[model samples]
Target: MGNTINRRSFLGLAGVGGAIFASGLSGWATAETKPGVANDDFFFVQLSDSHWGFEGPPNPDARGTLQKAVAAVNGLESQPDFIMFTGDLTHTTDDPAERRKRLSEFKKIVADLKVKNTHFMPGEHDAALDYGKAFQEFFGETHYTFDHKGVHFIVLDNVSDPAGSIGDAQLAWLAADLAEQPADARIVVFTHRPLFDLYPQWDWATRDGAKAVALLMPHAHVTVFYGHIHQENHHMTGHIAHHSAKSLIFPLPAPGSQPKRTPLPWDSAYPYRGLGFREVEAQRQETQYKIVELPVRKV
Candidate 1:
């Protein structure tokens, strides 16, 4: 059921910090780095799990909430160089037409982003159906690589399985991709699920992610940014750092925080509860980067 065709043959294109109280549309976080590093630095935004069609006691106005995130990014005094929506652009659906509609509406809404360039990967809800045909129809290939400034970014699709697996074909492609890159190049990976086994009982770990991780282990500078757990988590594999972004929709309980994994209900008294975006600044040192999590606020 997984897409076995070499996605590369078909295709193209395309962190975390503490709480700092701020009045901006989103919370502000800044990363500390050596002096002069910020000179050649660049910043980009990451927003995940908008869940556009979700409706219930957990954030009744899901669509409006996503709009506010867009507005928050637009309101930034200095726009990021680009934006990446890690996954779950729309809530899952059984109807094919409705699925496409949700994806379309999501695109239309995000099209208003002041930053022109945007990259997207698929979450299980977005791609598990029909092997992501609907998502690819509106967006492009699920897995691909591109270069910007100097960093090399690899966007992997692991959501074809509910348990999350990258499969062997993509691994081969990734091996070949890394073979061509300079060893010193800064490599950033993006995916929908945690590539490592964070919590298997809740479907949080990737089935064959260990194999992929093994391949990446040879690389000196590798950092993976992903979303799906719906909360901020930081982990390290060898020299690489893996960071999960907080969701724009609703927050999920921390790994094994409770007996089961469930969405934390939004508190009415607290505005923009458990929703925010991550701003990443690339420092002058190829291996150094800083991240700030900005929570959504009333603009």
Candidate 2:
């Protein structure tokens, strides 16, 4: 489904402790949208790398930044059909109890979102903790498939291995899942790391992503959304368009822009710099779908 609504405004988080919208959403056109209207046009927000429980100079109040993101979503003029957090829900820890605590806190914060249908995927940070045991307990089924509004959505777990590989089981599952869908179905994939070799030197590429990409190549309309590098990036694999969303906590340098892969320092003067979500305006047609990436706004 596609919408013509001009929800193109940016949200600036005032400070670290309290999340306030520096700029509000304007230029919205009212529609006859009801509580549960089955329309052909709808949109969703992609929020990633909130990094709750993170404490450091890069972002002191990681928890509050996530809260601000929630507030920004709630403050939308019209609620999105759904919201999906691409991963790194929390900063990782080796301690079992501490991992649970961080996930628990993240769940509590996201519970405030007005959007009822929210999806989550795991990044290396969460999946590396206990080899995804702890993450699965908190968020069920790291990799799965679902259908919504004539589109086939697949969530892949590519971070369970430190080297970033989606194992054989998941690959077989992906093959089976794709086999079920029609050849022309509009497919959307969500994951944590870049499915392509964007920058292998920094652990940015998914080791087995080529296999998955090959599986998806048969599909005519495919779009992949993921986050791990903590920046907005776009790439093309055959006909698939892969987009990476910005982090809620802090932004990282562009692919190979910096000598080292480190979180860019936050500027106190320009707060919320490079921290926000990706707004996707998707439109669905009979046999195909289209996606347009709106500007990455600070929220």
Candidate 3:
């Protein structure tokens, strides 16, 4: 079983307050996705755990590393319709000022991008302590739905409640939200923590993910994307496919492979520093799906 590492304790040990990354650079990951002629037939980028306010051996220049991730998204030949930053935007911090500063800087970075729509969700690092109240103040609605092309986009907040579960209130909201959609509509779900049992010991999987999955089971086509694990992990459960993206902060060991897992330390020797994201192109008018992990380095 692959394990997802927890970043909360790591942040405390490193004492990332105020400014976590004054300078740093990590690795790279990117996917090649060309858009079709249809304006609506475009792919999107998934960015997670940039941890703008982080300074550790994993990334001596975390700031630079996160910048690279944003640059890659902006440099795409054909821009994505929008960008979704699943969460862990800032390093875990009890200091409200640091949280506010981190998100403020994050906004500046994304504002520089050319994409039209960019959304966010909170990770445990962000919500475990504060319930992501600061995140909501910066990004607006944590859970909402929208239609893109023919796909129904649902952004869920798995970090809003204690125990890292979707909670009864949000669960009810999700049920009602899906009820409003037509039967045949395709759906795409975005979140910070995985909705499946990727690794229970590490708190990587959501407590009530199965209930949420059940809600989308009737749909003909569905895809779920998430972050927080800091690596590329994918699984197909029934009709839904779940995928995780890499962290701009640092790399982590594969799930369950080690007695303890944490983000891999920065290997300056490696090109582009070891940071990356995911590129997903929802196949139009078909059940087939294509998703490629985009590394900061050349494939």
lDDT of 3 by residue, 124-157 (tens): 7776777778887888877888876556789899
* TM-score per model over all chains: 0.84, 0.85, 0.82
Expressed as tens digits, the lDDT of each residue in 1-299 for candidate 1 is 12221211111100111222111111111232234433335667788988878887687666687776676567666677888999998899999999999999999999998888999988888889778899999999999998765567899999966547888899999999999976655678898888899999998889998888898888776888889988878899887788888787788898888998889987666555666667676655443433334433332
Q: Which predicted model would earn the best TM-score?
A: 2
TM-score of 1: 0.84
Error of 3 at 50 (Å): 0.5
Q: How do all the candidates rank in terms of lDDT, highest first?
A: 2, 1, 3
Q: How far is candidate 2 from the true structure (C-alpha RMSD, Å)?
A: 6.9
Candidate 2 backbone collisions, by pair? 1-40, 1-283, 1-284, 2-283
Clash totals in order: 4, 4, 25
* Candidate 2: regions farther than 4 A off: 1-6, 10-39, 285-299
Residue 136 alpha-carbon offset, candidate 3, angstroms: 1.4
Which residue segments of model 3 deviate by more than 4 Å? 1-39, 272-274, 290-299
Tens-place lDDT per residue, model 2, 1-299, is 12222244424323312111111011011232122343245677888888888887787666578887787667767777898889999888888899899999999889998887999888888878577888899889888887665556899999888768998899999999999976766678999998999999998899999999999899776888899988767788876778787788888998788799888987766666777676665543222323333333333
Which sections of candidate 1 miss by over 4 Å? 1-39, 285-299
